[model samples]
Target: MILVEGIGPLATIQDLGRPGWFDSGVGVAGAADCGSLRLANRLVGNPEGAAAIEVLLGGLVLRALRHHTMAVTGAPAPATVDGMPVGAASLLELEAGQTLRLGLAETGLRSYVAVRGGIDVAPVLGSRSRDTMSGIGPEPLRPGDRLPIGPVPPAIPIVDVAPVATSTDEILTVRALLGPRDDWFTDATALFDGEWAVSTDIDRIGARLDRRSGPPLERRIRDELRTEGMALGSIQVPPSGQPVVFLADHPITGGYPVIGVVVDADVDAVAQARPGRIVRFRPAG
Candidate 1:
């Protein structure tokens, strides 16, 4: 078991996600930066889909109740065990009563902390991921909460330190395929021509982008469209013309027409982009 000593902006237990519930009106809620969480789990010799703590903007503190192997990945948040510095993407050992602390993220918006056996939180809908939009799974972690660890896996860790590319660039490129509704826009090419700034309204549901230096995405069709199913990474544009790229907790359906769908592999880049950071879209093919 481990105790949450302190928490920062946001922290929640997450695994790969609860998929296949979309038709039932459930979004696949999980770590925003899924790649980072997977890497953290792998480094600690756990399955890639093992549940871990997703820390937003860092500043999460945990106290160990038993000996455990751990790893921190994503955003390169400065981490320390009992005040001694520890590197992200490297194996860490926490003895009973030892305290682990994470500082503010250096670049990205979220971080993942994975233990060897994973967090043994009770699963809801076949997953341990917390859905902020639908209130599924566990609530956001709070200080003083005690988390149980799962039984140790038979397989041992093969690597101690792994090099990972952290989110450090202020301007990021995200690739997407145009048009399930590109024709609705006056000029869908503007999405690739303009550099959009990540807005402060970002959350697990979506990342809204502000037109930093270009015209807003003007839609030719002003008539309201019937509600349609929305997918993860759908770049939905509302009447305001600003685009919102759906994320892990995005709604199952939306009224707005989607101009594009962000590439599945590139969604992590969108998730990690900090407020005011620039994002430039590119054609997928």
Candidate 2:
């Protein structure tokens, strides 16, 4: 069992996320860096789909009740066990009564902590993922809360820790494919080749970007269409002509015009981006 001594500004338990619930208006609220979270789980001998703590912006302090193995991955937070600095993506054997601490993330915006056997949170709708958007599972975790951990054999899978550092500069290049409603815009090329600035208004639902160049507001289509299945990286442009790149917590149905969909591979970048970051989109092919 793990007890939360200090709940960071943005910390929550997440797994691979509850998919197949979009029809019910539930967004799959999983780790922003799903790939890194899966790898951390595998490294700690836990099920890849198991729930882990998705630490946002860092500064989380917690304690474990039993001896366990753990791994911290994604976003390169200054994570450590029992006050001792530990490298991200590396495995550590922790003892009972040990405290885990993390500082502000230096590179990426989000980091993941994978316990030896994963957090044993009750599954809701077949997922332990806490969907803040739809309130699917338990409410966001807080300090003084005790979280359960599963038991596992000693054959913990060990992996070589290769730290990945993505560019945190103002301009981030993201690959995308033309979207479902691409034809709605008179010149789709303007949407692709243009440089967009990540607006101050950004969150789990979507990141609003200030487009430097695109179809003039005068030429925008104001017709609202029926709801449709939304993809993870859909780049929707509202009537204002400003592009809002949808992320993990985006709704299943949106009335705005979808100018493009960022390629699946580049979705993680969009998820890790903080406000004021610049996003440059290019064609996948």
Candidate 3:
């Protein structure tokens, strides 16, 4: 078991996600930076999709109730166990009663912590992920919470340390495929010419981009769009002309037209982009 001593602004339990339920109005809510979560679990000898803690901007502290192996990944944050420094993406052993601390992220926006056996939380809708937008699954973790650790697997972790990407770039280049509704816009391809800034209004639901370069995207048609299924990284351009990139907790159905869809390979970078960071789009073949 692990005791939460102090938690950061937003900390929640997440796995790969609850898939195949979109038709029932359930969005796929999981770790915003899934690549980081997978890496952390791999370091601890757990399944890639195992439930783990997603820490936002770090500043998290926890105490181990029993000896356990753990790993931290994602954003470049300073971590320490009982006053000793530990590197991200490296396996570390925690003795019972030892306190583990994570400092604020130096670059990216999210961090992931994974224990050897994963967090043994009760699954909801076949997932342990907390959907902040839909109010589904586990509640946000808080102080005094006692998280049970699942039984460890017999297999041992082969790697001691692994290198993971951390966002430190001022401008992020994301590859996107042109649309399910590109015809709705007058100049859908023009969106690639100007740079958009990441807005402060970002969450698991979506990332709103600031149209700093020029006017909002011009629509060729003024008719209301029928509600359609949305996917992660779907770039929906609303009436305001500003583009909103759907994330893990985005609505299952949206009325706005999606001009483009960011490739799955680049979604992790979108999760790490900070507010005011410049974002440029490229056509994905």
Candidate 4:
């Protein structure tokens, strides 16, 4: 079995996510950088739905009680096992009782730690992810929280993790299809045609964009009409005309007018976005 001994900062159990629970008002709480998590799972030969650790900001320290294969992905952070400096996007063969420590993240906000058979956590609502919004499963990892790792499935495949190339481009393009309420923002064609800066107000709930020009929208949707379902990347604009792009932790229902929905492929980039980052919306059509 795998073991996590010394954990620091915000560490939480995550899997692919609690999908299909949106109808019941549950947010899909999973790895913020899901793409990286998937890769780490593939590296360790675990199924895509395997549970792992989602390290926020960064500062997680742990150890393996038994031999296991692990991988670290998402963001550039220095991780080490027993001070040997074994980290990055590669499969690691951790020996029994080896100490694993994750240092501060250098470039990104969240990182993922994937184990061979995934973390041994009971499923709630058909998933292994923790819903911080709903207080589902265990709460975020606190100091001295003894993490339980599942039994290692017999064999782990060998994987090669090449050094990841980081991007520094100012323009972050996200594919979007227009309108659940396109008519509301008729004057703001620039929402699709213009460049927007990632507002400093961005967070797990949503990422707001700095508006260049648009008339303030009236939150006209009646209370009766506010229970509409939301797709993952729906870009909703409230009375402020400031767009709050929904993230994994967003509520299932919202009162604002959704002007567009971001494309699936670019969702990971949206997940990794930091405040002050510049992003431009592109029409998928």
**Which candidate wins on TM-score?**
1
Q: Could you tally the backbone clashes for each prediction?
A: 0, 0, 0, 1
Better of 1 and 3 by TM-score: 1
TM-score, candidate 2, is 0.92
Question: Which scores better on lDDT, 2 or 3?
Answer: 3
For model 3 the local lDDT of residue 256 reads 93
Candidate 3: RMSD to truth: 1.1
lDDT of 1: 0.93
TM-score of 4: 0.89
Q: Write the per-residue lDDT of candidate 1 for residues 97-161, one digit (tens) a residue.
A: 99999999888889999999999989999999999999999999999999999999987999999
Residue-by-residue lDDT tens digits, candidate 3, 147-194: 999999776999999976544578899999999999999889877988
Q: Output the worst ten-in-a-row residue range by lDDT, candidate 1.
A: 163-172
Q: Indicate the TM-score of model 3.
A: 0.97
Cand. 1 TM to true fold? 0.98
Per-candidate alpha-carbon RMSD to the true structure: 0.9, 2.0, 1.1, 2.7
- The global C-alpha lDDT for each of the candidates, from Candidate 1 onward, is 0.93, 0.79, 0.91, 0.76
Model 2 residue 272 lDDT score: 80
Task: For candidate 3, give the lDDT of residue 198.
Answer: 94
User: Best candidate per lDDT, number?
Assistant: 1
The runs of at least 3 residues in candidate 2 whose Cα sits more than 4 Å from the true structure, single-residue gaps closed, are: 153-155, 163-165, 168-170, 212-220
Instruction: Put down candidate 2 lDDT per residue, 127-158, tens digits, no spaces.
Output: 88777677677667799899998877455585
Model 3: lowest-lDDT 10 consecutive positions: 163-172
Q: Higher lDDT: candidate 1 or 4?
A: 1
